[model samples]
Target: MAFTLLSRSPRLVICALLCIFLFSEVGVPRRASALGINYGQVGNNLPSPPHVVQLLTSLRIGKVRIYDVNPQVLSAFAGTGIELIVTVPDDLVPGMAASASQALQWVTAGVRPYFPATRVTGIAVGNEVFTGDDEQLKASLVPAMRNLHAALAQLGMDTYVRVSTANSLAVLATSYPPSQGVFTQDAAPYMAQLLRFLADTSTPFWINAYPYFAYKDDPTKVSLDYALSNPYHVGAVDPYTHLQYTSMLYAQVDAVTFAAARLGYGNVPVHVSETGWPSKGDANEAGATVENARQYNRNLLMRQVSGEGTPLRPKLRLEVYLFALFNEDMKPGPTSERNYGLYQPDMSMVYNVGLNQLSTTSAASLSLATSPATRTDVRKDFGSLCLVTSLAILLITQALLL
Candidate 1:
């Protein structure tokens, strides 16, 4: 007969799990975090920096990208070992390009004070300067990036922090098959300069790609399951490359990659600077329900932990930064803009994307399962621990049948 005592006590199951991990022959190795979040603060009702830090730590989020180099945010992240990617706002880019000294001044005053302690890894020179027909701003984008990178070099911090800019998917002229992806005629001239700069500096090319917008615009034509990357969904196939894309995010990423490849800078890595689904939207906005938001983010997190990559670049696992940690009340945009957040101002989850501490544990376990090196001793670990885990599950199975 099964041990009734073990079945009755949940604490015993917890102890059993601890022993399995602590005594397993195959050691759990530390892996670099592929998950990152955007910590935007365009709202007044958001929590304090320290409180925000606590919330992020509780979720085991180690990397964050903020819209600007906010001092309070930086100070709060110090010694927490959370890597930060700070931005130099769009309005300030022109001035940084016009005068190199201003670039140095900006870094010295804004970034230097919190360096090393805060773990600032990258400085985004500007966010989507190519959005409007702002010729002057687009022209200054590379110069501002150069000046900022030079400023880092001046302070002997060039080796640590990388400099780049975030762009919108509007830069693409053709992205239908992904292989046909190319820069818009108007954006090409500026993008060429930006691509060369990215290649020279060895920094990633950042782009904000939102599949929700596509689904919202044409819900009848677009598959909601495919957009949300739901399992068993029949995805798209690029006619030219014949690459099978099961997720919209991967297709969008490869579209950017192919666009860069057309320009002869295919070697440069493309990072998703921002992507998320809004839990709420205006009456006209389709597929913006809370359930869809929960499904989208939950699936995205699963993809990251599994170390899944785009079909085109399967070996290079995609590095993505999810947008807006909290729903910002003061954000000056449509209803969707204010709603693309995992949490509300009160630290309550808008929709749980598995943000609990257990998610981190799950990530580690997933990594361990995928590692070929760990499989060598799988028998040894599973043999010893399967009994305990099976008993724990048997209780639930028996209860269900009872």
Candidate 2:
């Protein structure tokens, strides 16, 4: 006979769930721990670094990737227990490659001071360098990553903090069919060698895949449902693998897997370093609307919760860093460039994924606001409000006199 545990009361189940929310490690349930956020700060009016840290910690988000190592942010995250992935700006690549000691010094200065307290977990060396015009930078990318890894190894931080670099989809010349994926001819050799390095080091291959770009660039061809993860057409079938793909994002991911397989490093894991749809956009930038944004992220998060894998790796859950945490005002390009955030500068949700205020109330006791002694930024919120009010009064008096 099949056996089952004696049933618990409804009240007990609710209480058990509450305990899991407030006290579980990362407080996101064991299954959701793998999801991550990309914390880009190319804007002037974002919440103070401390508040940003608070917001992530309060929401129980465990993994986050910042585009650059801003010390203020690093300092703010100290003791917050959020696993941060820090980045090295492109200009530093040549220097990091020229000397291993320099790499060590850079890490010592940028990463060492905030250790167990800050929960820094990874270092991304020079993002998208392979796709840039700087030939010198492209050449230095792998060596720089290797030296940085070596430096971390020397400091005994390599085990916990891995070294990696993020790549843009531009690296691939043809990615539509998935199975026939191939890297750009000029980038092929370097990518092959880089794949070998990642395979040997057991590090993930980080790719910044954006299905929105595909849909926008060829609106006549790409399906909106395929891009937004709605019930849609069977998108494309990989000729070689014979796997049918239903969405552009999954097809994009499988393309990377196929490309790596072509290089004989098929076992190396691929992670999405950035992917999100904008809530607003210019007229010609089709598919960048709040509805699409909500659908895309909501469906993506649901798939993540299900622990589903790409067709290439059926059992392994795909790790993703959602494109951004805040809408960056200073980012160049079309209007869509600044609108990928899931939250606005004021820390309000752009699109709710069932994290309503009521559901998160029990979690409020575990919020960062409770730990005033641990972070001064939470306290600064009051100070900033006072300052803004004072300025507003001054402006009103001047207007009355005029």
Candidate 3:
């Protein structure tokens, strides 16, 4: 009788363990303040808007930024409670700036149709206009923004939808010590005008800061661990402010803050409009590996969930939007340019970075694909699975005894 009972206990224990593990995994609540993702549709093979909406909802990503106002995407996102930031293309800036009526028409046609239902929270005037050599477009960016704001105000949507433009980190002439950060001389006048508008309207200064570019350009000087925000990296300290920076992303953010302060708009909030690490790249691309991407994104997501702020603003949580939600095979530039996505064209993950609905096979595949060094680092940094497994085993053991 004791032998019979012991044999049945093993099967019962296995069943109980499976049940407990499933319950624990599914019962975990998602973070309330999750970070945002940039949904770029430059690729032809990307999923449809409905499928994309379902994918984002499954992942519990509540905020998204898109390059244009696609009516299909906007309509699909209606009633989802997912906040959206849409953009006006560069070509439209000149015309919009030339006439307030044109701006009003653009807003009415692109924004008013699906706003309250779709939760359209912001409108970007143009992307990275300051980094380009187009003097005319650069000159028109502020005026276009002002016109858009006025249009929104006329329609009673100004309080809900903010207007601003995203700038690349190349606009900064100096960003080393965080305290000595400043915009280039040529960009200063345009930046001051833009900053005044932002300050007056209580809008955020959007910056696309890519630490990968810095590391790729000078791997000998830039630390890969620092870029990945690994705990093992010994970070740098800004001499003037004495603020220690564990991650290049935070340092870059504070640099923008200081730059804004120099223009007498120190209190204006800064938002990361685009930032991400590619899962794969060409042979020449440094620190572009599956493991490094996992570490960079996972660490960044953990920080976002923790409501972390830059050294300059301790109380206000730094809002960030991860770049390129889907890998765009058609994106022009280096190999890394096409591979910054957390997901592939088929909606499969590039690696397990704590996203929802990931299968056990996907997780195991990720472990096998990464380098041994990254495997070790991942094991050290991410212990949530191990904790869950241990707890499930303990619960099963208790149930078997009962």
Scored by TM-score, the top model is 1
- Each candidate's lDDT (Cα)? 0.77, 0.73, 0.78
Which candidate has the top score in lDDT?
A: 3
Worst lDDT run of 10 residues, candidate 1, spans: 366-375
Ten-residue region with minimum lDDT total, candidate 2: 1-10
Q: Measured by TM-score, how close is model 3 to the native structure?
A: 0.80
**How far out, in Å, is residue 265 in model 2?**
0.7
Clashing pairs in 2: 79-117
Q: Write model 1 residue lDDT over 1-402, tens digit each, in one string.
A: 113322454344323322332332133223344678899998989999999999987777877999888899999999987779999988998999999999999999999999989988889877888887678888888999999999999998876788998999989987777766778878887888998998677677999989999999999999998899886777999865667888888898888876775554555668898998999999999988899998988887888777676776665557788887999999887899899899999999887777674455744543211223432343334444445435534543444344
Candidate achieving higher lDDT, 1 or 2: 1
For candidate 2, the per-residue lDDT at 78 reads: 89
The Cα RMSD of model 2 versus the native structure comes to 19.5
TM-score per model over all chains: 0.82, 0.80, 0.80
The pairs that clash in candidate 1 are none
RMSD of each: 17.0, 19.5, 19.5
Candidate 2 C-alpha lDDT tens digits along 108-141: 9999888857877788988888889999998888
| Clash numbers, per candidate | 0, 1, 0
